[model samples]
Target: MKYPSLKNYINGQFVASNSARTIKVVSPVDGALLSEVTMSSAEDLNDAVEAARIAFHKWSKTPIKERVQVFFRYKFLLEKNLQELATICSEENGKTMSEAIAEIEKCIELTEFATSLPQIVTGEVLEVSKGIECRTEHVPLGVVASIVPFNFPSMVPNWTIPNAIALGNCMILKPSEKVPVSSGRIAELLKEAGLPDGVFNIVHGDIEIVEAICDHPGIEAVSFVGSTKVAKLVYQRATNNYKRCLALGGAKNHLMVMPDAIATMTAQNVVASMSGCAGQRCMAASAMVGVGPIDHIIDKICDEARKVVPGENLGAVINKESKDRIEKYITEAEQQGAKILVDGRGAKVDGKGGGTYVGPTVIDHVTPDMAVAKEEIFGPVISIMRTNTVDEALAIENANPYGNAASVFTQNGGVARYIIERASAGMIGVNVGVPVPREPFSFGGWNESRFGVGDITGKSSIEFWTKLKKSTIKWNPEAGVNWMS
Candidate 1:
């Protein structure tokens, strides 16, 4: 099922790119040519930025309540076409149907959160002195942009769009060229939901466009989600240009299991965490540390992993390069003396021999120094390590540079609390594998996982996309005055 050639969404119009270079949007499911996206040039990016800059003046002054109505219609349209969006995401991203659906559901959830902007985007006021009043209002930044990764085509872009626009800021989105189809569809929905022209835009490209976004002076801030290397570079470039930026990087997330953890339940969650989305997500459990004597749990995890059939239980990796990279890590771990308990290399899907499928692979006896154990493989592979105590397990986790998320699987509340307090990661899960916080809690990581002052979602995003404007007024001469006055 080939799709039409993709176009850039600029100023609320689907404009075809003039760039000579184009990228083939191949379906990782079966190596089919789904679409061809034009590589948007830096000139295209400038056009988008200018459009957003022009729209920001009116959009920023638009009342918060009116801005929220767009999201209300957006949420309804998203739910109305949930299946279509999920299918597009699943085809382009190679995630399973259920996973794709869940991604859209998350987008809808964020849209629902954006609809509450009228209530939450409130200001503070107080009479600090006689005849003098001080107050603070959350005002939108002029123009902002979000560079979203391909792993989550719809959900990740929504991470910034709904909140940023609902708060009255215009946004430019650079969707990964690998999976740009869903974002174009999303752009249509936003327009149908009555988002004004130039309020939101989508440009497709690789590094050139990314660097353009960072260097574009018209943009007031930037939000990025990608690999650690790129995330850091984006943060530096954006900040160097004196723009507020938040760049969420890659993670080597660890899931530690205690001896007291329920073997069946723990194994299921561990397997799901490592194999979900083919383990391409940042929140995936790539490192599994068994604290104390938990051979039974390890065996159970391996057993559960073995049952995850490619294309049935687990989806394919993004592409052949990712599949080869994951297999290389697995092979290296085996050569480095780790046990390949369940090898996913060369896994195949029925009638889809060209598909890039990697089954659920389990590597046991992995040490801290192995590349598979230390680095982010971004695949459906779990490296199992053993530690005698929780301290040792956490020591290994803490030593890792990326601190996106860490989870503890145990029934003991004391041990859970102990790990929670010292996990070093920004997000922690007790008995939960993927610890992505729901709405209202905000989502971000510490250390290298995130670069910037605030998170990309929830209330923190409100702060990221808007600036505080404080006003101090004196209606009349005051008899007494304080230092603030």
Candidate 2:
């Protein structure tokens, strides 16, 4: 099927890039072309940045109430077209309908949260001394960029956009070339919400565009979500250019099961977390750390893993490259002496031309030093490691390089508390598999999993997109009398 040609949304309008080169966005579900988008170049980036810079001068001065009203209207528009956005996510990103809807719902939740920007962007006022008052306010940064990933076409961009724009900053969003459709839809909704031209813009391209965003002087800040390698490059380049960057990276989040935890229930939760979205989420548990008598736990996990059929019960990974990488990791793990308790390497999909499917795979007796155990295998595969004690499990979790999230399945309060206190992960889950925080709190990781001081979403996002200024004033009768006084 020939899908419509997609263009970049720049200066509040959809336009073709200066470069005639285009890339096909292929669906991971059936390897079919969903659409084709322009391969944007540095010139396109310059245009978007210039537009955002021009718009920021006026938009930043707009009243806070008026800006919030735009967000309110944007929230309504998002809700109205929720299904359409979700459908686009499913078509291009290869997530199931329900999963895509959930992602869109998260975007809506962020929009709703942003409508309360008045309260969120509130400043502090204090009487420092007699007749002296000090106040602080957060002012918007200019022409911030949100470089989002294909795994979350809608939600991740919302993490930066609504909050950034609500705080009165203009945005230049560079959506993933693999799934650029939803971002254009979002830009359309922002326009309908009365956002000014260039207040919200979309640029579509690959690394050159990203480098443009980093190197351009007009872009004051950037928010990104992707693999660790790319996140490091983005962070380094943006920071070196003196731009504020929030680059969230990859992870190998572990799900620790103690002796007292119910094996069957823990297995169920582990399987769900490992298989959901084909384990593309950064918080997905890539390893299961078992403490004491782990045979039964491993068996339960294997049984649960076998029940998940990719492209049927669970969706495929993002693309053929992702599928091939996952299979390679599984094979390498087996060759390196890890036992494959549940093999998903041979999983198949009917009528999908060997779609990007990797069923739930569980490997047992994996050591902490194994490459598969140490790396972030963003697929539906879980590695099992046996530890003699809870301390050992905690040590393993903490010693890992990526500290995105950690989970412990235990009814005992002590063990759960112990893991919570010592896991060294940014997000901790007790009896929960995926511990992604909600809109009220920021999402971040420690160690190599994240880069930058502030995380994405919540109040952190508000602070990241804005700069603080403090004012000190005194009401004195002789105010004009003496600057020296």
Task: List model 1 lDDT by residue over 1-485, tens digit each.
Answer: 37889989999999987698998999999999999999888889888988998998899889999999999999999999999999999999999999999999999999999999788878999988777888899989888999999899999999999999999999899999999999999999999999999999998888989998999889999999999999999999999999999999999999999999999999999999999999999999999999889999999998999899998878889999999999999999999899999999999998888799999999999999999999999998999999999999999999999999999999999999999999989999999999999997799998899999888999878889889999998867545666756
Worst 10 residues of 1 by lDDT: 476-485
Q: List residue ranges in candidate 1 displaced over 4 A.
A: 478-485
* lDDT assessment of candidate 2: 0.88
Best by TM-score: 1
- Can you write out model 2's per-residue Cα lDDT over 1-485, one digit (the tens) per residue? 44678888888899889998888888888888878998898888889888888998899999887898988998888889989998889888888888899998898899888888897677999967656778999999888999999889999999988889989998989999999888878888888999999899888989989999999998999999999999999999999999999899999898999888888988899998998888899989998899988688778888888888777778879887888999999999899899998888866788987478888898888998888899988999999999899889988988898999999998999888888899989999988899989877889999999999878988777779889999988778554444423
List the pairs of residues colliding in candidate 1: none
Q: What is the C-alpha lDDT of each candidate?
A: 0.93, 0.88
Evaluated at residue 433, the lDDT of candidate 2 is 92
Best of the candidates, lDDT: 1
Compared with the true structure, the alpha-carbon lDDT of candidate 1 equals 0.93
Q: Check candidate 2 and list the clashing pairs.
A: none
